[model samples]
Target: MNPNGRRGVELMCTGATSNSSWMKQLTSASRQGRHGRVLHLFFTSLRPGDRGAADTHPAAIPTALRACARLGDASSGRLIHGLVLTRFPSLASDAVAATALLDMYAKCGLVASARRVFDEMPRHDDLVAWNALLAGYARHGLPERALTLAIKMRGQGLRPDLVTWNAVVSGFALAGDDQMAGDLVRAMQDDGFQPDVVTWTSLVSGSVLNFHYDRARALFRRMVAAGNRVLPSSATIASILPAFANVTDVKRGKEVHAYAVVTGVEQNLTVSSALVDMYAKCGLVLKAHRLFDKMAERSSVTWNSMIFGLANYGHCQEAIGLFDRMLCDGARPDHLTFTAVLTACSYCGMVELGEGLYRAMKEEHGIEPRLEHYACMVHLLGRAGKVAEAYDFIRAMPLEPDCFVWGALLGACRSHGNVKLAELAASRLRTVEPANAANCLLFSDALASAGRQDDVVKMKRLAKRRRIKKLDGCSWLESP
Candidate 1:
């Protein structure tokens, strides 16, 4: 059994079957982000009848709902909600309990359900419910709806507080509306609320999402200049580090690292993961590995980042080893983890291992293959000169193969001088990416290499007729 499961069993052994004891464990697990443990404790404490441990300890229901929210287990959340209806019907009228239900639905991406709960709540004066619903809409890509709800909240005479303003600002910022986010910040300031770390972090995170790396850096600098007034939090550090990572700006990344250290957020999982990613992207893989070794905790993101860095820099063997270690550490491998490991297998020409991992990913881990995973498999087989086998794999794919899949096949065919398969792969690629001149250009080169002058001419003519010209590639160098 896993360590957590063993610990939970021990807790159950010592708790003497008391509902309060189970509730304490449930609340503790939920607070610690151990949602799975929270669920386990909650369900184990339940009896068959309506008046079970859950009814005796009504507070545990909201805590369980919160765990369901964190896990995105909407089915389980609904079960808990139904339990409340049947066993603890009075909880539906308690604002705190009802608000927890509303928040859970919102966090689970069930915005309509959240809105329904908000509308049905007995009290309209509860600003917590309003904020919960507002945050739900704001977070779920309906910034306009969030703003509308905020206005409606004001109409109900519940004056918008700092949290209310931050929710709206975050919504706009996250949606990439920098101008609107700025306007909201000024508006919040006018209303006697200054932009806090959360406010600045939202703007920084939005800038990063919108590919405004320079703007994100500038905003981070401004936030730092705020000095003791409003310090950068772990979220702030994590959000801004990606900008440096994407730009390969190691100097700036190092400065941020020093700041994280000074702020004592260097040990934070998210910040540490971002730091590893930044160092790796900046061509400091060894340094990244060192940092990874020093980390006391490693999330899936941390492992994936390190593995990708190793795979990308020709450390395929080490990358695969790290993946095994990740499994040993009991970190559940996600889609990205498979992608990184498969990439390593592809890079090292470990075709058999790659195939085994691919099957295991589906059969053992239950992670259905995504397009990128299929692309990686194709690349793996194609790189090993298994051109026909790669094509067969593509045919067996549940998804319609994208340009990357066909492109990998074509590139492999070119490498192995398989002109016939190259032509077929190029044709499919062109069909998928009709305006991509690179497809025609690649096929033209393949034909030229095979002494098919007429076919090469035809490919060039097709590109010219379609007005499809490959854009010139460029590179950026960070100034010293």
Candidate 2:
């Protein structure tokens, strides 16, 4: 035996059959301190072939089970499960321990093992087991499986409690299945389950994913009217706030901010970040800046959100200044952070700043420039009428440039009336996106603008041959 294993055996040999409470102390220490070694000692202290081990209290088994779960030691959990079987089979029958076992298996990513344990349980009446399985499915991105299991659970005459319903709703919302999630909410209401804050939050998050901002707002209103004591979490606020960004109705976004204040979720990091993003997206960069300044604590995500918000609203200088401040404040830039900063440079035609940041990202921060960063560079150079330089930059990139890069170049060529370069960029774009009506239309427009009527006619003929139709114009009206 290994020396450490031998030492454990030697310790066990001395106290193999002792009821001196040392075993109990060791077991308690393992549970309290989450020390796996103490548990090893406690288990080894049990006499070999001790038939009376099963007489241990059920409470002791949960403590051990919890220790195994916390440590995420599946082998220890399995061994403990066997010990429970041999010493106290009744512990396995205990609902709480069974749930613990299910949870342990789930946490270890052994959902199938958890399901087997669930199937073997004598009583399926345990709602905790059902919830554990639902949570397991949800955590693992098996939303459809979770939904199917939930339906089966209901079919078996088991009414889903609030936790079970929440799990299914959250699973669907996260999976981007807003319609199915909404249907489930309607079903829950039909089944006489009143919508709680969790339910409303789930619906709002799902609606936001589907870009149904109005529905999200309406649900928020209903949540307030219901007066359920269940408060909205920061996650709920974050999810819905971004939906208001693209909406022209700044008034609705302000209403959301007011609700956040009233509900006391405004101070939460997620909610605060969302408020900053919403204000910037709605063309209220000053409000966003004010909120950012007032935050007592800021995470990297908080800084990134403000940077992106400022960059998005054409406050490029302010964004660059904030980026510098973020670095000064010891916040490291993530990929999205760099993307925002690069976009800011692009918006302000600050090619030098963009190029410097790009180099710093690769050399200093060890972050490789992504396609978006390159695209931003292309847009920056193109906007400055350096079409040839932009084309060379795209050609020399480490990775293949996508249609966006070519499109940016083509737009630049059109602006500078470079017919030859426009044709070259459009030709590359056509191969990548054969059915792109916008590319054809833009190429035709460029040709016409350059007085190349013959080329324009030929391009129109190609569009007709490809059965590409020109886009129709439409406008949208947002509800106040």
Candidate 3:
């Protein structure tokens, strides 16, 4: 009734009675490229952990495998693989089924098993197996091995498919070999294999993951220019959003938002949340909030983004309110949520309230304090002029304190004229960051407040000896 041939089978299901007919739908849906629907139908067809005749059901296995790849949920894929090994070992030898098995195993990080499966098979040289193994190596950051396998596949008179080419390109990207990746893209084009959104997204992701922000932005521009040639996916939008966030490029961020809206790319939950975070981080929280409110669905990530954005822009009370609303909405707050709210409390000098939330985080929420949470607590207590208690808190910490924890106390010492504690904090700071001129200056200020001019002069001389230049001040202003 939906008119699309793809949905025809669902209509047929109303009168379908036979188990074989149901299994037929599995193969049918997969062939129609309804991967998510295939998975949904597959799981619903049987109860969890149920397997009998369907174990060797050739059609069922491959569909499940494809679903795993689509979901990027390796655990589900591996479970399917385990079902195969346990039920029908012989079906694992069929070329199409075996190749799917190999691909699933490789993608799920069982490369060694995939290789063993490939080696044991009579059709070991099948292009599918070759591509699967190559992709495994490429995905796991073995660029050299992946490239070598590409050559070997060629030597064996096997032409690489689009998948093989993408894996190799992605491998180079993962290795931070941008030049090699670019060359491969050109070669791929020359070979008559036009890159799809996955291919371009992989390249963009590789650049972003490796901190090549400029290259990422340039690649995004290239992606936009070729948008007519290959439509970008939600993933492509998500991958490029962080590049705009890192640079605070609000103009480009707006362009990306428009692109996502125009392309319907923001329909995906991850992309929508990423857009929210990008807007929030680019000094555009109002825009971020509008998008957040508009999202029909949200994960903890979206809520965390709103909370973090509010705290970052000095909306402490609002951030705390949002945290309460998040809990009431049945969204469990993670360590990051607590860290953001605790930081807000610290900023607002609500020491008792901050400590209560810290305890509630562990007792009520069952989320243990990570280092950043401890850092927030230290900053909170220290800023309240309870320097001795802060020091004791640091000592009682089960985990080792980092420079941030000590730096918080030292900053407090400077504010409160606690010269003795400042000396201890400064001494520790020197071990952590000997060249930090601001910390040194703060230490000197703490000493000067106690009439210790000689120590202040010594601090300045030590800074001069180290030749550490003072950090330049930076501020933002809105243009009219």
Candidate 4:
């Protein structure tokens, strides 16, 4: 019988002693980015002398499955799992292979299939399989299920590992349950699992995901002070740098850069990009530019960071120049590159330049204009007092005009005191964002500027009736 599917493990395995060799071969294949070779090796290969039972060898399914997991090749993983079934004749009952299979399927976003495999397996008190299932649930946005499963796992006499604790913490963090996430960290400590750098890193990334920037920064500081055991890794530092940038805390961002240097993570591409982005956001475009120039290698992300940083600081000429350099350097501009350059054109009043780039985005790059790109264009036209042209552009939009598009138009109207256009923009904004009072206030101000006191009175009454509350305005400045 030729080797195929579930009945082929007898042909695949020769001896248990070959586990290390099998792993070394598969791991090498994975490192070389030979996912196809991995597939062929597992799914189509026949080992030496495996045709006879006298030459039978044990196969290492777990190691091969892990390589597949790392490469995100679930197709290869499933084939390996099928071979495990035939060789062991108890695939579902085997803890090691079952756990790996469960993890691979979960990471591939096939949770239903993962759960099916878990259910088919005979119940056991092992923690590895249980943790895999819990991680799958957590990673797939089923945090409640993971939490409940954690309780269930404990009831079955299984102890939670550091991964299990990390899953629960990360789940709560993603769910924006900061209190619960902190509680789990304490519980992990009480359970005798010292929080590693990964543990803190997860919390930091989660906080950023959930928009808790201040908390992310605090976690970064704690991670830095974690003694000799867990100094901030490049990832931990990279994660926290953006929080400081978001808050415009340039002083702290500088401190993070210094920390990265001492930790030897600053020289990494990811950390370097984050540093460039941080400096740019903090109004240090030149610093960001210098850092970009010094990098030995550049990815799309690095180019976008420098472009966005320059554009955001109103350095239209420099930003657009850098964009040209990026293309010359064989770096293809993404949607974000266009957005940044277009934003620079808007702030600098380079209308013709902006329009040409917009056309280039579609004709040259084949990238369609997204909402943000359109919004930037609208602001570009509106900021130049071309109220009528901006309004016509909004009318001709391929997609339904969203709040940001109309908001940009309304702001332009407010700037130029175009009462008629402002009223039109205000109507759309009110329909789309009824709860926002800024629209009403802007409309009233625009009407008053045009000496339409009665219209202003009516607008104020409308705002009062709707009970729309205005958001508080706040600004940040870096200290001297």
Give me the candidate number with maximum lDDT.
1
Flag the better candidate by TM-score, 1 or 4: 1
Q: What lDDT score belongs to each candidate, Candidate 1 first?
A: 0.87, 0.78, 0.82, 0.80
What is the alpha-carbon lDDT for the whole of candidate 2? Answer: 0.78
Q: What are the per-residue Cα lDDT tens digits for candidate 4 across 159-190?
A: 78888999988888878888988999998999
lDDT of 3: 0.82
Runs off by more than 4 Å, candidate 2: 1-133, 139-141, 151-160, 174-179, 186-193, 228-233
Clashes of 1: 0
Could you list the CA RMSD of all candidates, in the order they appear?
Answer: 5.8, 9.0, 6.2, 6.1
Per-model clash counts, in order, read 0, 3, 0, 5
Worst 10 residues of 1 by lDDT: 1-10
Work out candidate 2's RMSD over C-alphas. 9.0
Model 4 scores a TM of 0.77
The residue-level lDDT of candidate 4 at 426 comes to 92
Task: State, as a TM-score between 0 and 1, how close model 2 is to the true structure.
Answer: 0.71
Per-model TM against the reference: 0.94, 0.71, 0.79, 0.77
lDDT of 1 at 469: 84
Q: What is the lDDT of residue 364 in candidate 2?
A: 93
Query: In lDDT terms, how accurate is model 4?
Result: 0.80
Candidate 2 lDDT at 116 equals 88
